[model samples]
Target: MSVTGAVDWDQWLRRWDAQQTVYLPDRESRFDAMLDVVQALLPETLVALDLASGPGSLSQRLLRRLPKARCIAVDLDPVLLAMGRAVLGNFGRRLAWVEADLRDRAWAERLGVREVDAVLTTTALHWLEPDDVRALCTTLAQLVRPGGVVLNGDHLAFPLHLPTLQQAARTLKGRRLEERRTAPGAEDWDQWWAAIEAVPALRELCAERKRRFAWREKNDTPPPLELYEQALADAGFREVGVIWQNMDNRVLMAVR
Candidate 1:
């Protein structure tokens, strides 16, 4: 439970695993879709980018699946990055962390690598404003090499006309997650934050995270999938489209 300078990585991974399931019950299925594409399109050994990676969730999962691949996991949250280093230990240098804000236009240069084979992001980019998302994809197009891939999975919503359907879909997923949430030692989002706050050693890091992200408003929702498609296309991607989807949460793929 000590998510500080010295954490029990196994225990932290367990908590993160449970919390991830609470957020996306079908996370593994979606990951499988992502992995399938990566394996099919990418080389046997490659360098990939993990955008806005939190606590090394997708990075670790990617390593577990593709042992030969190296990942550069980038995020601006020092708190999560600290936990990631503790839990993931740089993956013996195969997995590296870069502290850069995705909102910044020149973030790609901070990655140290000029270009990469693929870039993957999940449940993270939606936090950006519409303009920021467009800017990010434009930069992504430049960062990725020709024939490289970019995959982003998040709650890409439909327009206002589907309000009723959206609410119903949300309610169904919530109820389903709630049913299995009572399992022993499970931690929901609020509970996880509570645990982080209750720990004396983690307080300062958490405070810094709050200060960093306090500027964001809750209403900063993801734009429609069409906009994402357009952004990638405008970014000069050779081919861009949705490859996997489940209601609001879908993976958009683009080849640079």
Candidate 2:
């Protein structure tokens, strides 16, 4: 499933990871915490739905950790999906790349499976609005089997009741992110995309990506942790809470 021999998908994926680190300096640590929770809660052969799974970042790690585990890596971006399919598709049957918009209710139906043991996403769900996220939870409630779980690792905002703390945390995180962006050899988001667009192998895929997401608008602010808790509770999850955190960035867990 790889592209022509001209493109080095491995190198592009590495650059993708580097640019992502500019926003989340402790990205690897967060991934570790998330995988630790998955290992503790699920069986080695568990089936996981990796929503917004850009270039199989979490999916690759989970596959390596569990060996027998399977991941359905879902994303709408054609460019990233192409990269993931090229690089991680070697996992053979253990990993699947599904192209679907998470905001669309029918996205889950395309997975071809009735249920999964866990649904996981990281640093990507923020692209969704609060209502869309709630709707996604409702769909996930049906998709995840009873006794299963959902884990979201991202910057979920603090409650408005803690306004001062929220502002302070946001400022600190912004400062830290700026520092990371200025680090030697760092590639910012725009720079990464520019590089991708400059590559002939990905030109058509990039154009397709633009066509797919051109109508979508990103949320200016991330949804609060409380909103996610309430949404999951309403969606029938038995238990929901933050299992790991660094500043406002946290891993929210919901057990079915």
Leading candidate by lDDT:
2
lDDT of 1 by residue, 1-256 (tens): 2354554646756786779788788888887888889999999687899999988888888888898999999999877888788879789679999988888898888888998999999888888888998999999988899989999988787767899867766776667777767767668877977876666777788888888898777653556887888999998998987888877778999999
| Model 1 global lDDT (CA atoms, 0 to 1) | 0.83
Q: Quick one: best TM-score, which candidate?
A: 2
Cα lDDT of model 2 by residue, 87-168, tens digit: 8985968998898998897888899899999999999888887889899999999999999999999999999999997998
Model 1 regions more than 4 Å off? 1-6, 161-168, 180-185, 219-222
The stretch of ten residues in a row with the least summed lDDT in candidate 1 is 1-10
Residue 236: error of model 1 in Å?
0.9
Q: Supply candidate 1's per-residue lDDT for 29.
A: 81
Q: Which ten residues in a row have the lowest lDDT in candidate 2?
A: 1-10
What are the clash counts of all predictions, listed in order? 0, 0
| TM-score for candidate 1, residues paired by index | 0.91
